[model samples]
Target chain A: MRATNDTVSSRIEIARAELTPIQFATGLLFAAAIAFVLVFLQEPLAHDAMHNFRHAAGITCH
Target chain B: MIVDYLQRGILAGVVAGLAYGMYMAFVANPLSEYLHDTQHEHGHDEHGHDDHGHGHGHGEHVHEHAEHAVSETTTALVSIGSGALWAIFLGGLFALALYVLEPALPGPDGIKTYVLAGAGFISVSVTPWLVLPPAAPGAEQLYSIESRLAIYVALIALGAVVSAASIAAYRRTATRHPAIGVAAGAVPIAAMLAVVPSITPTVVTHPELSSALVSAYRALAVLSQAAIWVLLAGTFNWLQRRADPATAVDGSHETLTTKQ
Candidate 1:
């Protein structure tokens, strides 16, 4: 029983250590995805909107 | 796991993007302009129309303009695509380095590994931008938007890969070594500096500025890139630390347990 408990505890610890880095890595991956969406989609949307607004406003003085 | 990856990826990506974007805006863009001007001046001299120079100036200007357009188009394709491609490659390299280095250091839970990965990614991503003149001459302003975006994407991808790989590798090693991580991260910067001359044009002449200005600008470009990478690395380190089990115990533990 003691051996089993030790095995279980060690397994848990191992699992914990393994998952910690994975968790952080996952965070980074997710962050990258968000950045992609922002750069590819969100920024373009904002840019188009701003362009249209400026056109309508006749702000082409430049 | 998916959500966590997405979150961290996006965070690191945005931070990397901003850092890269600023470098592009202030340094790379200016350097490209200088290169373009010099190229045009040389072109004019090559034609040897000293007597009719004024008359041909306008024609030369138009030709320069066309050249600028072509350069811009090509640069857009190369800079964006190549930048992203290199970022992914560099990320893998950083991870591999960390994996090899992790066993030799002393620490707890691979904090060092994570730090090293972050630093390595930042250094590699920023170094090329600093050293390599804009891929295309003359159209810095035109291609800046597209090229910068591509580079940013690449930097973000690189950071994500490096961070993920290093962390994964470090976890497997029995002895936790943070120094290995730090050293791994620092190695790439040294490597980049060593190779800068080979990859980048040396002693470029500029029509707009004296030799001193060119040198000063080049130096500034390097400093700006280094500063940007340092900021990026610091941000990633802070994020990792915040997410580390030892630091933010309650919230991170809860998150970890729920995931388990």
Candidate 2:
């Protein structure tokens, strides 16, 4: 049990160190696209579609 | 894997979306409609329009009332539908944040999800609200829409940075000087809450309307937003566990991922 715990912690450290640039970029792109649609899109129809949810989430919609 | 993250995100989104829609339809919608009506009435009074006889016969007025009811139903349905879509998108964002931050986040797997979700709420909702409390319909706007949007976006970025820094600080000192980390995290948020509200004041456009109603709506807004974040985090963590039955048994996320 003691050895298993040590191995688990080390493995976690390895995973932490393994986050590559590609994965980081992919996550960033996905996040940015979603944020734009949900918060920053200003086209009238799109804006209207998201208006109530934006207001509920306190996103500065009129 | 990236696909796994997206799948988990979409699934979590679906759950949060439904809950958000239902909450809006049942709890928040009525208050919003009341505020809308109050604004309409206030506008009519200002314009000196007759309450019942503004260019419509009594029969026409009845017809109009029926039409308004129909439209209200449609509005409620549309709002709920759109709300679900919005929540789903937010869930996608939540998943992506988790993907990026999971390795670096402190605590065990389950606790990490909650921490990320709490940070998300602060980044996206709570911090923006410090500058601009969730406005009930008909609240007077002190800034142009563009200006308000700019400030909101800036505040969200600031909040995200502060949250990330706080997490990093906590992780660095958690075993040694945890109190320092806690203070480091709390002070910025406390300062923002105290200073921002005073700098950016919101005016009540219609004083005659019930203040209680506005307060109720704002309160509900806060609760609903918080609920969505919590649901998204819970659902995401549940899915992660389901994917790794070994972890489900041992509560260890590191074992399977490292092997992969």
DockQ of each candidate, alpha-carbon based:
0.05, 0.23
Cα TM-score of candidate 2 = 0.76
Question: In candidate 1, how many Å is residue B258 off?
Answer: 7.4
lDDT of 1 by residue, B157-237 (tens): 554455445445544443356565545544444554466546544322234345665565546544544453444345545
Output the lDDT of residue B188, model 2: 63
- lDDT (Cα, 0-100) at B53 in candidate 2: 29
For candidate 1, what is the lDDT? 0.41
As a whole number from 0 to 100, the lDDT of residue A5 in candidate 2 is: 47
Docking class of 1: incorrect
Off by over 4 Å in 2: A1-52, B45-70, B177-184, B203-208, B249-260
Candidate 1 chain B minimal-lDDT segment of 10 residues:
B60-69
Comparing to the true complex, what docking class would candidate 2 get? Answer: incorrect
